[model samples]
Target: MTRHQTSNNRAVLRTAAVPARKTLGGGGAAFLAALLLLSCSNPSGPKRNEAKIQGVVYRNDTRTPVPGATIVLERPVSVATAGEGGSYSMAFTADTTYITNVIATMPGFRSDTEQVVVVPQKTSTVDLYLRADTSSPVTPSQSGDAANIYLVDFTPEFISVSGTGANDVAKLTFQVRDAHGTPVDSAHGVTVAFSITNGPSRGEYIFPSSAPTDPRTGKVTVSLNAGTKSGVVQILATAQVGTKMIGSEPVRMTIFGGLPDQAHFSIAPQMYNFPGLDWLNRTDQIMVLVGDKYSNPVQPRTAVYFETAGGVVDASGYTDAAGLAGVTLRSGNPIGNDPVYGPGFAYLKARTVGENGATVKDSILILFSGFPTEMTLSPSSFNLPVGDQAGEVFTYRIADRFGHPMAEGAAVNVTSDGAPVVLSGDVNLEFPDTQSSSWTTFHFKVNRKESDPGAKSGNVAINIKVTGQNGNRSISLTGYVAY
Candidate 1:
């Protein structure tokens, strides 16, 4: 009876407070009320800070640190490079990840690249192993020490072969013998691939030398039965390194197709060859047409592959459509007439193609005999600044009696005031005036001796000589100076 009376009294109190009370709804109301109680009792905790990351890079093969190697943190953000102990340290926030690259670079050692990742507050370790570098120099790139490996029925030096068309197959064979020319059972280790450039594509067209090894005679077949460029090309065996340079000897073969089309172009007799036209003097408007058997007009962007073991080509063109497509030919015209190249045996090749992109004309072959062309500097003179060394500016052009820009990268012999300098230098430079596909003009920064503070100015002469395969140079020059 007392408990019932007390509950009735509480109900009376609730009814009395209803006029002054409001309601709070949902779990949010419960949370807010709890928060209020807590605020009256306890305080909130402190905030957390961002995380930090760090690490080191080492040599994988030797288990040693590879110092001086280039390292990159290639992720959320990048940090790089290890100091002297082959050790590196870097920092990052907790939530981010990073990629690290390590490159190996040491002489007589091969190079390599590696990757890694790092998370916040965590340290990552990445390392690398670099092998020694071993490759031949087709260009002026740095190469390692090498012993010669001579093969039979193959040219170790660059050679050329002709192809039927874009898809034509070209073949050549090399013997896998010892340095003494004795065939060895060595074909098993050969890995051959072709470096295809300047063709329809612009990278390696590899043909692995991994052919079936002969158990008996130890003879390996070095053949390029596929991926031969239609024009003149320098094909060589590219060897990969890990062990000795001795296995699977590298061989070179120059493959070419078609005969050179006999071509002739005209220039106003005075532009270059006027009464005093010195050799290598460029003409203004090379106004001659190329002679090919095709009834169709010469394709504007055809593969007019022009090259010279002798000199460079200048294709500074007037037309915007084709990037200056120039070639340097052997300067002299010792070339005689042949069925392939009617008169100019300058080894020029011209081909016609159908809509299907197939060779429409037979590859023409040009055979030029006799001493090659001469390269001479025009005005053969100059007055250079006393303090500031000025370059030698000259006008040079290539023609086959008729005129045209020679192929590209021609060998030109240049002399200072009559003294010999570089044998082969500079190719077709951009011409000066009218935007015609005619003659090319260029300024050669006349290399000068460090100007002596004592002498104010001096008179000198320069000669521009054209070179040939045999190292012979055709010389011409002008008044030179050093200020």
Candidate 2:
């Protein structure tokens, strides 16, 4: 006997062996025969190879399971819904390894996609995290309605004091965000308030200090106007969500460049004196630094007028951000002929409008040195007495064209033609001070040397040379060395 059975989409074949009574008909009465039976069932084909992908969907920020989420697979196109536990699984008939994108999406949440590799006969686990969509309003989390208040943009962080210019006002913008970093707008009942936490007393004021966040951007903007005082101002933005208050990091701004004051207005030059006389096309820098009554630098671009009694000076200049203005003082006509060094003096004055609308002025003196024009040797002739150490002192006076002493650091070199002279004392002119002389002097000692036969007794000639920026002069005087 043979039997065939089918169950659970599978087929089974059965075979049976039995003894038969009529196998040999002629020996009916005596013999028993054996029979064999074979049964064949219809082919059911080979089992299919498959790969699976499974994972759980979660909230991006909270990492909590999100049920009722749809998981979609590309490249064959299959979809599955997350179960109560936020778990989803999809199967694919695959012969080898392959890659596919799995996307998890839910209402009121942003969609997230992850690429997964599916190996034949194996399952791949992929986790997807989704964030709350900010395009549309979302319910606030139970933990805290507002996560943080952010300072989005603060323009013109530096502003001048009141009535300075167009830059005296600053704009500040803020945004309120939830725990998921999604901007929360008025729909969530979020409002932002601003205050000056730390700064100079009443140094700044804000307009529209409190406002509700915009529905689209969740942002609030305000304007800050500077006061008369100057200092650092820190503004804080706070958001009110339910009974909780969220504050952002402090935003810092600067109020600088106040009005100038008389006490703090002054002028200085890069060099007190330059070769302004006798040397054409010479220039020096004249700088003026102005400050407010509080010792802060005055407002930038403040005009300062310059005037000079002698020589040429820049007509005017504008102060820089540091309240410093500079002008060029050039050597030109109208030279001062003071007695001392005939070096001309250029009296420079810088004036500007002060805080009280009065003229604040400061002055400085700069000297333009003249060229050496005169030279004299006292006792035109001298004699060194006969001795191994015999010496004579000679004095030389040098002066400028106007009888004033030569400029400081003027070089004077002396040499002897017929006598051995050991020269000492200042070879360079001394810098002039309040009490200066009309002429600069140099001294030299003429000695009769025993070492040299020619130095014993003979007519000696002295040579002098004076070098200056304007010109050079050389003079010779005759003397005698006697034995």
Each model's lDDT: 0.35, 0.68
TM-score versus the correct structure, for each prediction: 0.22, 0.55
lDDT of 1 by residue, 370-479 (tens): 23233334655555554443455466543323232233233444455432222224432322222123543334545445533454345555555544321344555555
Question: Which pairs of residues clash in candidate 2, taking residues 3 or more apart in a chain or in different chains?
Answer: 340-404
List where candidate 2 sits over 4 angstroms from the true fold. Answer: 1-171, 175-184, 188-252, 336-343, 387-391, 404-418, 429-478
Report the lDDT tens digits of candidate 2 across residue range 1-483.
Answer: 222221221222222211221112344213211111110122322655776777777766545467777776664456678886677888867665666566676666766766666666876677766665444233333222567878878787467777643367889888777785656644564767889888777557988889887765567898888887777888888876677788989989887767778899989887564555777667888999988776777877889999987688899999887889999998878786545334466578999887558889999877676666668887788876766474667788776655455554556787778656555554434344211454466677766666666555678888888875545788888987776
Highest lDDT among the candidates is held by which one? 2
- What's the lDDT for residue 261 in model 2? 80
Worst 10 residues of 2 by lDDT: 31-40
lDDT of 2 at 418: 67
Worst 10 residues of 1 by lDDT: 10-19
